[model samples]
Target: MQVIATAGHVDHGKSSLVTALTGMQPDRWEEERRRGLTIDLGFAWTTLPGGRTVAVVDVPGHERFVGNMLAGVGSVPAALVVVAADDGWSAQTAEHVAVLDALGVRDALLVVTKSDLADPAPVLADVRARLAETSLGDVPGVAASSRTGDGVPAVAAALEELLAGLPAPDTTAPVRLWVDRTFTIRGAGTVVTGTLAAGTVRTGDRLALAGRDVVVRGLQSLGQPVEAARATARVALNLRGVAVEDISRGDALLTPDAFRSTGELDVVLVHPAQRLPAELVVHVGSATVAARVRPLDDATVRLRLGGPLPLRVGDRLLLRDPGTRTVHGADVADVDPPELRRRGAARVRAADLTAGWDADADLARRQVVLRSEFVAMGWPVPSGATEVGRWLLAPGLADELAARVPAVVARYRQLRPLEPGPPTAVLRSALELPDAELVAGLVRPPLALRDGRVVATDSGLPEPVQRAVTGVLARLAVEPFAAPDTEALAAAGLGPRELAAAVRDGQLVRIADGVVLAPGVEDRARRALAAVPQPFTLSQARQAWGTSRRVAVPLAEWLDARGVTERLPDATRRLR
Candidate 1:
């Protein structure tokens, strides 16, 4: 499906032309029909000769309602520029052409109406010459008379040929449907109509409207009920969770999270003759808001919007001075722009925008950037770009992290030698790195990961602590399970700190609190318990170990916990 809006001066027979082609009245209100002028937007659709359906949005061409006109055509991809044979070109016609040019609308059809009343050759020649200078240059033109229906078939044929060349809408892109009309039906609840510019909308899909989610209870394309609707079609959505009063003409139904609303933008102006005024009315999509402009250079400026708009890069906005009635065009360069803090910051930013993304330069300015955002801006990652998960960092940043790890681990060991080295999470926080993968990649060579902690490969106990560990192990070897208590171990300089270090180094195994054993003692105990009967008593197990109850009891319980034995109801133990 295709949508084409009418652009011309008032009383130029735009509505009449639509009514003649589609056989349906474009005027909806009684006041508009009585006044013989289209005060608000009107809609009508027709089947072309090639069986292709096209919808027409008839916009009021008066100067006072240019805002309404912009709302109707801001999202429409193609248009039919209407001019009258008798009037030739007028002020509103020129304004409309300027708006289309500002919107970057290149696909159009020039329709000269009232051809039966006046010879359209001169008017067609004049309109063609004028449009040749603007963005709608060298477009196809047709002479039609809506009253007598002469040459109307030629207009239809021209539209069919134009629609043939139009590209299919991108369904993969995010949906941004600008609401041009909203109302309530008797059984359908709230119905909002607009051109589905991109993406697809289905019956159960949820969309964001005015920061709130609303379910699509139903959908219609060109007045036919449908379960889903695709782009470039005139869509009427039956919204479930909103009221008629909650939505207005300018509110948009967008794919949630895919778009962001902002009140500020960085843009590249189109043929900016002079510095823009301090205040201007900016039109984007279907919404218009007053904004303040700050010039960055001859062709760049920063605009602060009066309200938030879901804008994206490459979107063309029409800037109009409400006071002076001047129109200018601009293309959005950046949505989330950086703040200019110091003097000459704007110039530097302008240079960045103009130079595009240079990995070296951007890394020097912005140390890190989210990989998703970087790619969305159409930047190519330089060769050897350092990426840590979703974060893209500078090469220098990785080198810096690698360089800081050793010192960090050394300080942590000096502070707490008994404990394992600093945890991966702690190291990440201390270095202010954003990702754990970055820390993991940086811990290399002389650094290694032990358990969950990062440590130097040579990290160990001091000379005195090492001697104490060796002495403690020798004593445990004599009586493996009959290990020394906390007091006896502390007396031998193997205190809690030294014991913990030994356990971490695999020199000792801690069976229970204050109970340390040599590494091979648990295996010997398991072997001894296996030789007993199927179910044996605790006294028998203690006798087998040849130790006192204090040491024997904990060791037996530790074996039970390790699944080597199970305690019976009568206080006997059995091998599993």
Candidate 2:
């Protein structure tokens, strides 16, 4: 599928030309229908003679609605840049091209609309000259009059040919569909419709909605329901249980764990769009987000984005000034995280950060990100931050450390019932690591430390309950294979939260109602039953072992069925 945005000056006949070619009006709202101008954003698509369809997004051309135009045009891989043949390039002409170039839309065709009203030569010549100054210098041009319908068909054919010649979009990349419109249906629940700019969406898929998750209940291709839609296709999604207000234009629906959010950004600072010395807005995907610019010494600065966008390395953002409304630059570097930071100059730069932590491997990467932001502000990247480098850790190790911390603390609580956790040094010794490196592996910016122990901010368990859970395990270890009654747990001097936490962590196994055993008791019972001569009966076994029937009956019966013992049809039992 191929998608294109129509970008141009206001009232330059962009909407009329779209209607002439598609036979479907781009305007949908009643006000727009009456106003006869493309207000907000209108969408339509067309099928060429070879039977290939191309989706067209009509962006608002007025100066005031430039932001709307930006949101509409931001994701399109190509564009139809409209200029008025009679009036030549309007105020927005330069701005539109600026945004397109900034967004890296090199594959575009210029449309000189309203051709019948005036002489075409002078206007076409001016557009030709303007095109030379843009990344669209080699872009094709076509003239059309919505009124006379003189060159509309030819324009369509030209667009289809251009689309046919372009390379296919990379669909295998992680999907990020920035929503431009969201609404609700009576039976369908919430429906979000948009052009999928960079990825694919399929039915029954779970998509992370910025901060939460929503399931894809259904989908539509053009107006027909379908299974999947890839990049450069218009899509409407029926999402199950997600409310309409949970998303809006510029919200990215992406795969969880695939996109990371950061307030900091790295960007290349150059353009055929404009000579930008002033700060500008950065629009990426469908989000009309803005970031202020200060030139870094090495052509990179940390950007504080307006929203939690799913950006990664090599992701391109369209830059424009919300105030002056011009596209400033094209293509930015992705430092490490996707975060928003200072608007102008910083004390740290990427160069300085690399200089400091390059040897420690773990600390080196973190210091680069932290110190870069600091240097951009022109502030000293603090010694405290540098000290943090001593504790900086690899992400995989940190994750492993995070996963083990709760259980570790739980074990600590067990071994020292009075002292919930031993010193960090003891923990290091237990894990067989030097105290310093272990602390470093479990401590750092992304990880946290409290009460002298490292904890994962993302790990949901709290400390007090973790201690209680530990206490339960300690008590259980002392009295293995014994059934601990509910009241007995209450009697163990364990809090309700601690008791619950113990169960949650599998510290004690609840075998039946009010019949809980120590963690490994069930396995021990099964093993012992396997060695028994016969399940003649619990009473018979008690007599043989000289122990109590209370200990033998359930254990023998459980083991008898576990293939540890065989029960005869007469209800007697023997080891298998």
Candidate 3:
């Protein structure tokens, strides 16, 4: 089945023409039938000459209901553009044509209604000429009067030809059903109706609505219950987990996590000659929201939406002045635009967008974005973007981040000279990276991770700490076995923290708490013990090194712990 919308001026017989072709009344409301005018959208369908079915979305032609008209035609691929033979063309007709043209709706059949009341040739010729100026250029024309059923068969034939020419709908795409009507059924809870433009909706399928998931309890198409409905077909869904009041017109039933809802978007004007207003109402699909426009350039503008919509690049939007009949078309260039915070950011951004909406350009601006989010926004992963697990890094972004690492590490070291380079967390923040894995990946030569902290392998201790270490090592050089006492160590500016830094720098060896010796002192002590007998007492070992018990006990214990010496049951130690 295929869906199409009807467009024309008021009293141009748009609804009447639909009825004549479908053999059913398009107007549903009692007031509309009584007043002989369409105030809201009406629906009707019929099978054409073959088994192919066509559904008609009959929109109001009156100027007051232009919003309604826009909603009806937003998702339809083709349109039945109606014009009365007697009226030729009217103000509403022109607006509707502009809307179709702005939306890039190309497949249409121009119908000249009320042929019995006036000559259809002039109106047909005039409507065709006007359509030539828009995207719907030179569509086929048919003169038909719903009153007398004149030329009705030719209208059906023309519609079949139009439907045959339309591109096939993508059934495997993500579902985004724009709700045009919502209400409660007698027994089925909340039921919402819409045109399924892409993907397929099956009964019991879970769909996203307003950030919550709702189950499809039942599904129907063309008043008949169905298990599933594919694209280009109108469907009504019985939903669970939501009340009727919660759902409204213009809300979408979506494939969960398949789309990104964004409030700020950048768009390029479809018709640059039509100047935009500072504020307007934006219509996309069946949704309408007020927006504030900031001009990026004469050809582009930024739209700040009152509410976020599930939007992406290449989506078509209709900008309407709420107080006037002016309507402008725009193509969304960026759904997640950067903030214009700098003095001339707007100008710079305008220049960047001049290349149009390319995936690489967006990736270049964002630097790094989650692959899931990039896909959700309907953006293809650009070639040459670096993939770091779940994230896609812009070209050269990793190198740029890596280049900043040394400076950040230097600043950190300058502030806290006694410590290693910096913690992984610090590097992550300085590089503005989202994950620690990225920080690890950016570590270059001479920069390495030591005990989860980033460090420069070739770096040395701070000058003050180095001076203290040099003083301690110099004293140890003369007295190889004499470890400095607490007071002497403090006098040389060797506190516990500084001593730890010296030990990490391989300048000092810490044997026990507060007992530190020069590097390779353990080997020196082992050789010194070789001069004694195979097994010696602690006092004898103390004599061998000519150091006091305070140095001998810890050093002997350190050797035993390292398996360099063995202790017997009698408390005598012997070098291994």
Candidate closest to the true structure, highest TM-score = 1
Give per-residue lDDT, candidate 3, residue 207. 96
Model 1: per-residue lDDT, tens digit, 1-576? 899899999989999999998998988999999998888999999998889899999999999989989988898989899999989899999999999988888889999999988999999999999999888788899999999999899999999998887778898777889998999999889999999988999999999998999999999998899998888889999999999999998889988776768889888887765667888999876788999989888778899999998877777899998776678888887777889999999998878777763545555555677766655443456565688777778667778778888888888888987776889888889888776656776787778987988976776777788888788788777767677888888887887778888898787898888888889886788788778876888788887777778788888899889888888888888888
Tell me the RMSD of model 2 versus the true structure: 11.7
Cα-based RMSD of the predictions, in order?
3.1, 11.7, 7.2
- For model 2, the stretches where C-alpha displacement exceeds 4 angstroms are 271-280, 290-295, 330-332, 335-348, 352-576
Q: What does candidate 2 score on TM?
A: 0.63
Q: Estimate the overall C-alpha local distance difference test score of candidate 3.
A: 0.90
Worst 10 residues of 3 by lDDT: 269-278
Measured with C-alpha atoms, the lDDT of residue 329 in candidate 3 is 88
The order of the candidates by lDDT, greatest first, is 3, 1, 2
lDDT of 3 by residue, 1-576 (tens): 999999998789888888889988989999999999999999999999876899999999898898898889998999999999988889889889989988999899999999999999998988899998889987999999899999999999999899999999999999999899998989889999999999999999999999999999999999999999999899999999999999898899999999999999999888774366789999999999999989888878999999999987888999998777688889988888888999999989888887665988889888889998988888999888888778999988888888988898889999988888788898988787888767776888788878777889999988887888898889899998899998888888989999888887789999998899998887899899999998999999999998999999999999999998999999998888
Per-model CA lDDT versus the true structure: 0.85, 0.67, 0.90
By TM-score: ranked, best first: 1, 3, 2
If scored against the real structure, what TM-score would every candidate get? 0.90, 0.63, 0.76
- TM-score of candidate 1 relative to the true fold: 0.90
Cα distance off (Å), candidate 3, residue 42: 0.7
